[model samples]
Target: MKVILVFLLALGINLVFAYLLALGFFYVAEYFFGVCLTVKEVFFLWVFLLVVAPLIKLKFRSEE
Candidate 1:
């Protein structure tokens, strides 16, 4: 039960962090490029990074 509670907490924190990160990215992109992205786009980009980053780490690790 304790482990499950920790896992849930971690997941909630991760989601909030990802959302804020995405919002920051959205504003930065707009500031630099004048291209406005929707919340859906930002959310998808955030999730994509979360999925791809670990794969990239594994690939680099294997190459070493």
Candidate 2:
């Protein structure tokens, strides 16, 4: 149960990060270039977050 909860929490955190990053890009692009992200761009950001977030989590854990 603890393991499952931790996994769920990590997944949730990654989703939130991906969403925020996507939204950030949306606004930045609109402001600078008058464009929006394509679906592919959003999907790539989400996948990139999934790959990055766990490594960051582990790095912080090892520092403790």
Candidate 3:
């Protein structure tokens, strides 16, 4: 139960942090490149991938 609770909290925090990071990056891109991104689409895909991709790659590292 404790592990599941911690996992849920971490998941929520990661999602929100990822979304905010995406928002900031897109803002910078627009400032420099003059291309605008829709927040809904940007947050939906990139944020999910950003969080999951690293987890997939680092799956075994923590065991060391």
Ten contiguous residues with the weakest lDDT in model 1: 48-57
Off by over 4 Å in 3: 39-41, 48-64
Candidate with more favorable, higher lDDT: 1 or 3: 1
lDDT tens digits by residue: candidate 2, 1-64: 9999999997898888667776787788888999877889878976887678678678989999
- Clashing residue pairs in candidate 1 are none
Residue 16 lDDT, candidate 1, scale 0-100: 64
lDDT at 21, model 3? 66
Q: Which lDDT tens digits does candidate 3 get at residues 1-64?
A: 9999999887777676566667777888789889888868786766676667457546757777
Quote the positional error of residue 36 for candidate 3 in Å.
0.5
Best of the two (1, 2) by TM-score: 1
The candidates, ranked best first by TM-score, are 1, 2, 3
TM-score of each: 0.67, 0.67, 0.60
lDDT of 1 by residue, 1-64 (tens): 9999998986676566566667788989999989999878987988975655546557888999
Top candidate by TM-score: 1
Candidate 2 C-alpha error for residue 15, in Å: 1.1
Ranking by lDDT: 2, 1, 3
